[model samples]
Target: MSDARLANARWPDVKAALESGKPIVAILPCGATEAHGPHLPLGTDVIISESIAAFALPKLEERGIHVLVLPSLAYAPAEYAAGFAGTISISMDAALALVLDIARSLKKQGFAMLALVNSHFDPANVAVLRDASETIVREIGLKVAFPDFTRRKLAEKLTDEFKSGACHAGQFEGSLVLASRPELVDDDARLQLPPNSNSLVAAFAKGAKTFEEAGGPQAYFGTPAGASAEEGVASLDCMSDMIVQAIAAQLEP
Candidate 1:
């Protein structure tokens, strides 16, 4: 795997790679600049995405998958996290537009495939990524893949305990960051917010109105104290392996 990530590499290098007829896979680390409790960095999504991509790239390259990592899409749809101090969210429309445009650009550049390595678990953002990826695949003739990170399969393989509910800056995410970048996690500042008492499961659940109205006064969902860097590393290793395999399967002749 080349140390030359696309965000740092010159245009000519990217052009040459595209022109070389090699199997190219662009890893777009879709993330958000939002509050992840006091314990975690505001750019938790960005760090997680970058770490996952870094871990996955070499394994992917070994299988002849030329990986180019794009810089993290730092702003995403995070209405739920809006009440938090550091949260910076985009409108759903803007988020979708940005992802779609990036996908279209990658298609035009002649990359063989594009994979969205999303870290933020915002429902609206997930829907947009799914819609945009599908649209690009049909309209622009490019292959796009989005893998859910909070699911049972990933959780079971990555950690010993199964997740309890809809994940936010909870155990799953906090643990991931702890493992990958322990220096960024502040264990003492971790908070364990009460669960949503609303009938709805999350902020985007059917009857959601406002973040406060849906998920209580605070933006967070679960306990962040249980997070450990060891758990985070394990989760990343599991997900990276899964992503690498998915990319390989897609590239199979």
Candidate 2:
């Protein structure tokens, strides 16, 4: 197995690893503490992000990439989900600022690359991360990348059992949580919320209503009835593969 210490490693050890010329890649898992129906845990974003990093790190290390998985950023810009219970969201500005600072710190630390594994679907925050990445690359000269897992192609690769647009606390997120943390999922508590039939892409393109207005009353937009651990595992695997490919493409040579 690869030797990538996550929570256990201290700064001195990390610095020593860097000094030894070990190929190191820092993985920052970003998530939100929000309501995910009744079944999934409030920290769904945290679970997915950390799971992806944990599962992918060893694989990357096998390819000569030393990994350092950071703790998940549990507070995301989730104003839409804030209407629901257990949704603890941060402002877009604050989320962006925090991520930017983290990116800058990673750059200053002399890490070879930084990968942000984000699980939530906050478009505003995504834009913030994208802009921050650009700024870091341009100013601090850091090599960073955030893969877009929400793409239809990646989602399809993750699950064939669910229909498209079944995101949020629906089959996609529900199933993922089941796969990663089954104990946290309570099937009886699951609820099927109305789907956002409008085209998300179009909405984004047109700069339509904010996420809060778009998600509607329940603060969710998908069918949660079909969620299963098996499906979740498939989705996680697909996401891991995508992340691996992204890291291979973006990290410095």
lDDT of 1 by residue, 71-135 (tens): 88999888777888888989988987887788888888898888888878777777778788788
Measured by TM-score, how close is model 2 to the native structure? 0.86
87-172 in candidate 2: lDDT tens per residue? 88788789878877877787777787778888887776677777777877787787786787666665556554333443677777
**Residue 223 local lDDT, model 2:** 67
TM-score (all chains, Cα) for each model: 0.87, 0.86
What candidate 1 gets wrong by more than 4 Å, as runs, is 150-162, 191-206, 209-211, 214-216
Error of 1 at 116 (Å): 0.4
Clashing residue pairs for model 2: none
Question: Which residue pairs show collisions in model 1?
Answer: 175-232, 176-232, 178-229, 179-229
Q: Sum up the clashes in candidate 1.
A: 4
